[model samples]
Target: MGMTLVRSLFLIIHQKMSTSSSAILTPVGVRGMNVLDRAKFLRNIKIPVLKVADEKLSKITPICKQYFLKLENFKPVQSVSGEKLKCIHMNPEKIGAWTDLSEIDRKSLKEHSVNEDNFIMKDIELSYENWSYGTIFKAVLPENEDIVSGFTQVGHIIHLNLKDHLLQYRPLIGQVLVNKIKSCRTVVNKSSTIDNTYRNFNMEVIAGEENFLVTVKENLCNFTFDFSKVYWNSRLGQEHERILNFLKPGDVLFDVFCGVGPFAIPAVKKKCKVYANDLNPDSFKWLNHNAKTNKLNMALFKSYNLDGKDFILTVFKEYITNYCLGKEKLEKGAKIHVTMNLPAIAVEFLKCYKGLIEDEELLEKFDCEIIVYVYCFAAGTDVLAVAKSMVIDNIGCDISDNIIDIFDVRNVSPKKEMIRVGFKLGKEVIFSAKDCVSEPPKKKLCVDN
Candidate 1:
């Protein structure tokens, strides 16, 4: 029988699977299978597809398997439900194509005439067609304007701003002006070269001050933290908010890369102690300023450059692993949780702890979960190629292969593709201890011949 048939039969018999051991590769035939087709097949079946009838399949099924089902309903609590908006990219100049007056779509288009002047299309000719589009132009809100009404009529966002060209984008234009106004208010507002480019405005660019701002609140039970300084406000700031929203009262947080104390201060305000660590000398200066400015009980700020390898191993050993033959320390209390936002560079760091994890007794320590937000770049190649290569290279690691499909991938830079890989590690040292382990699957994966 085919592997898919065998696996399907196995699942029908077994309800649960051990997620740690066993060959878990999805058979090639099943890999490209469409969910809709599977659903259709499932509907016609009398027995639930999950109800299998084979003994051997049951033995191996649980070795490396877990399943999750989601039911969504519109409610206040469901606000965070990941509902995606569908879009189509239509060229304004090509509106006549298939847009006959008799067509209902053409009538809708006539009723809602979008302003082409407001739309931005570079050298490309503006044409209208049923092309996929994903993004809406929300109006730029000035500080005093009500943010809800700030958005103007719906206009399809055709293109995103390049890093260098962001100054032209309305949102970034406002942000840049605001930043410029703030910098001009500083005492030393004068032209100076910062990182090769000369700045026209003057500000005390202390360790962290340039990257962070200090603001105090009145009658506030707890300090409020803001991450307005980050260069990429929309993407990174959204991520920062997601992490902060998870905080609770008295929950100690350690932001290893506590750049402007975004995570640290918020945790502290919630009556939780925080340990903020960052190697950037500039970051600490602002971190201290913001803590004192907000009148928050300043938490510890460790300013040493944590060698990435050392930091990862330290986490794996102290916070993660426990039960090692010579070492047995529970990562309880405040130390139980740690935050590391640097996923792009974390793979390199995982190398150091390869040996310590091999000891099973110590493996249980790592049972504590990690919320890693990995960022990857395709480096101008196809995204599938990059993703497949990453999976094959990081072999033996107990990552949820299916979990990778849950990311919100976007083309941040033309030549760079971004993907976030988040997973919970098992209590087993899956890393190979052999030094100079040859790289796995370095070449691009070309699925289509």
Candidate 2:
């Protein structure tokens, strides 16, 4: 009876096996063999298998030694089989799979997942791009994606001009900027345009400290001022240095609108005499402070709080007269430079230079020429032409194209540009008795308080 049963099982397997499954099926000759031989044949035979659901397989896969099912072992079946299988076949390992992973690697796998969340999965390190404002707030506020890169830093303060759409996120953006910049301790957003003669705009603190007083270093000199009261542009550091490079020892500089002594103190440090004046009393006060702080002699550096036209007529005219009529004759290399930096109305002061030294004998006694650096705001496509016309029209004299050098300082807005038109004030332009204008042309007046 046992032999018959064994024979029947072999017949059933032989009938079910196909040419592809022949490799795994045992030879059908177990009916004539002994009971022990029949058992040995059954143990060596292989059978087709099917895979369980992935979730179910995962639960048992860790503990079992050979629970994996191979793709080749699976076949289409109309119904479930009753035969019990003791072993399973596995396919080749899939890509990125850890074939050597054991039940002991559970702790390591957990650590890898955590590291992925913290962005340290690889040896390469994360950079500023990973934590930039665009990356961190891109999903929450997509409109302010480019605002982070447009900030200006004044000493320890970060100045931002945020649009209306970004005003809601000002605090959050300011906090991120402070965190990113190591030296910044305060962040402020410009609340209004710079319309006042002092070139100061309203600002509100967004992060960190509330103080507006900042000390900035430029051209190796330190300047301290109240940012809310005076005008100070960190972007003009290069312009200050460029002007400084043109100075020599014993040279005299008249800064008509020297705010916080950005140009005057540095010039004094370079061994040049400076007559720095500003209409803003706050700027004049800080200019004195900065001059002293930079170890400049008060005798060589003079500070004045007077209107641009008044400063030229009083202190500046007196200085030129004394230099021309002094015992020591004016040196050939010595230069007199007048800087008018208030771009909105600085060009209007050019009329003040006409007949600045009325005494022809006193002007003729000096061998040096007066060089004027006048700044102006020009609009439209023809900025150079507009700037040239402004100087010629205000000075009431025809200036040669070769004598005037126009420098594009920067763009103030989409339609406006800041320009510096530097020219040598000819003897004819300064001392000519014809077309002499005592006062500048009528315009919006800037008064000293």
Candidate 3:
């Protein structure tokens, strides 16, 4: 039986009595267990032998609970700075609406109408201000000459104007509509950088060629980020402060696809022990640079290509062996948090590690957390299947029930597509689930052995 073999191996190999060996009979999960005859024996075993689903099964039911919880906490908070979104104004006559004409005039126009109906959808050039007039019968401009275009499609609410020109020609109708627009609301926080009326969470963004200095006016928490020569995109800034709320003290954070230390620097700033890495040399340079800039202790950065299985195995062995050979034995094992920003590629490394590594005794050596960003391309050709293939090649054949939590699927583009799934490792020892894009799509359906 698989359980019998695992127990025997653990008893024979495990000698050191550190934090991992507190007592006897710790529940363990055996993934990809092919011994069907021994499955019953393994199940009946006193220890908790958790069974993980294969890649094929996981795809069929990809809605892992851990993936959802992380997203619930990661979404951007409402705009804190009371900065209003931009709007525009347009002339009333150019808007094209029909009104103010008498019944006689209307009858005359109806006689000459193309549809031979007394009523017509006309663009009478109404101003934005006219929208506030309840009794006023007005005609709005159609979309691209399409008469069916509704009021919402005609133009933005800001484009309305007043038609009267006898006096100073002020837009009375437009002014009314402008008042209807709600004033911008700001989320209050000390770390905000905004000043005076805009004093909510204002960040002074100092963009550089390879790095940027972000200083918060309120909290005085300044962070210099290295972007591997790539400026951090505006979207990241939008979500940074919000995501930073989840960091806790003393947590070991690992940013696997760490690009210029966006997650790592903030994590270290929160006093978390960080192990950040990136395949790109430029990225690692910035990662280390940012780590030094923040003066984060216990933060380690490694540069390696995560696409290959052998490279991953070597890295894990080195980190584990190094930890084991350290001055003190791992107290309760290293509390590691492996962050994978690359969704399409992280799974491969996870699968490889799951297949190659199985050290129940060394469970105290490391703990991992994975962040997977699943980006769906077009929707036409069975995107789920493609996603399934991608998931299998990336995450490996089987996974453990050690799912901490997963974030909600985020839309990366206009189309309701592309999602990011973050996986936190739970109570069991397992490799990272986040994956990279190394294995191309193949016709073969992944088989779980």
Candidate 3 residue-wise lDDT at 278: 60
* lDDT measured at residue 230 in model 2 versus the true structure, 0 to 100: 84
Output the TM-score of candidate 3: 0.40
Model 3 spans > 4 angstroms off = 1-231, 238-244, 298-311, 320-334, 356-393, 398-400, 414-416, 424-449
- Model 3, 54-114: lDDT tens digits are 3222331221122121111122111214443111111222211223333454354344331
Off by over 4 Å in 1: 1-235, 247-254, 270-275, 295-304, 321-339, 343-346, 356-360, 364-367, 379-398, 401-406, 409-411, 430-449
Candidate 1: residue 61 Cα off by (Å): 73
Q: Candidate 1, residues 158-198: lDDT per residue as tens digits?
A: 11112222222333322222332222211112121112111
Q: Can you write out model 2's per-residue Cα lDDT over 1-449, one digit (the tens) per residue?
A: 11232233223221211222233222233222211121222223232232223334334335333434232124212122453322223222311123333445434434333111211111111223223332333322432134332256777787767766567777666776576556778989874466666667678898889988889777888889988888877667778888899889888899988989888998998888888998888898899998888899777788888888898878877877787788434455888888988887787778776777878788667566778899888988899888988888888888865245888887666678888898898767667664645566333244211
What's the true lDDT of residue 304 in model 1? Answer: 33
| lDDT of prediction 3 | 0.34
- What is the model-wide C-alpha lDDT for candidate 2? 0.64
Q: Against the unseen true structure, what C-alpha lDDT does each candidate score?
A: 0.34, 0.64, 0.34
Over 4 Å off, model 2: 1-130, 144-150, 327-329, 360-363, 434-449
In model 1, the number of clashes is 19
In candidate 3, where is summed lDDT lowest over 10 consecutive residues? 147-156
User: 366, model 1: CA deviation in Å?
Assistant: 5.5
